[model samples]
Target: MADNAKWYVIHTYSGYENAVKAAIEKSVVNRNMSDMVLKMEIPMETVTEVTESGVMKEVERKVFPGYVLIKMILTDDTWHLIRNIRGVTGFVGEANKAIPLTEEEVAALGVEKHEIVVLYNVGDTVKITDGPLASFMGTVEEIDADKNKVRVVVSMFGRETPVELELDQVEVVQP
Candidate 1:
């Protein structure tokens, strides 16, 4: 039985995140399982390292030292393929049931790009998803696709206040 593709965390040997990801990815392709195994990532961030001599260099550092994220359709075959990877320890789930990541969790982890699909048009009502104006409902005043920004007129303190937000920061409210 196959499940919808979602992000699942996997435990790995310390410092072997990349190696395990490569092995699983290669297996997925070699087995012609592109539809099953979709994405794999070892979340990393850049940091400046300063040496004793005051030489500063930017380096990519793993955010989660011993884990990898896989976006795949969960199934018996896929599970076996992932488990058999050389450096993979196990899935980051209770017992043997793999827990898929929540959309908010994935966003917080910065593992995937958050896509905002807004059906609301200019002069339509929308909801603020993130930022200081979170949960505030407002009307769309303007949209700037080039800048990926949207200007919404939100009612505050008995007045209409215009707010600027990223395209991904607002959602269309269904009536």
Candidate 2:
């Protein structure tokens, strides 16, 4: 069942995505299908807004409106339950046929679960892989797991500078 579980899109009424998600979850619980229905996710992104007063506010922006993504093992019973749930219009596929997302598509949509391995240590030499400082080698100054970011000290012209970057933007270099 675990191997078969995959993400599928369910079309819902406009502005009713969350409601449909809750209904599906309730049905899963009432029908004792926890093993089949793994998870329901509504993808969101953080949008930072700067006001005229120079204040910044972060807001959650739904990536897909009127659609909810679900991870589940597809079966007749599971499909029927999901299709009949309140606020669910239908699956995002051909008529009456549900298609699961491909592995590459899932990863591109940020729906796949990936295990991140930390390979670099503090004071280690690393090469910047992305952003404005790309291709530059820097020393890891600090690691912050809580924020999933790393601080690195890079040589900028003649000065040593500190830069904060996402964990993916750096690769450890051998001394």
Give the per-residue lDDT digits (tens) of candidate 1, residues 111-174.
Answer: 7764556567899899999999999999999998756789999999999999999998899898
Q: Against the true structure, whose lDDT is highest?
A: 2
The TM-score measured for candidate 2 stands at: 0.65
Summing lDDT over every window of 10 consecutive residues in candidate 2, give the lowest-scoring window.
Answer: 107-116
Alpha carbon lDDT of each predicted model = 0.89, 0.90
Cα distance off (Å), candidate 2, residue 119: 4.6
Q: Which pairs, if any, clash in model 1?
A: none
On TM-score, the leading prediction is: 1
Query: Where does model 1 exceed 4 Å of error?
Result: 1-3, 115-151, 155-158, 161-175
Residue 133 lDDT in model 1? Answer: 93
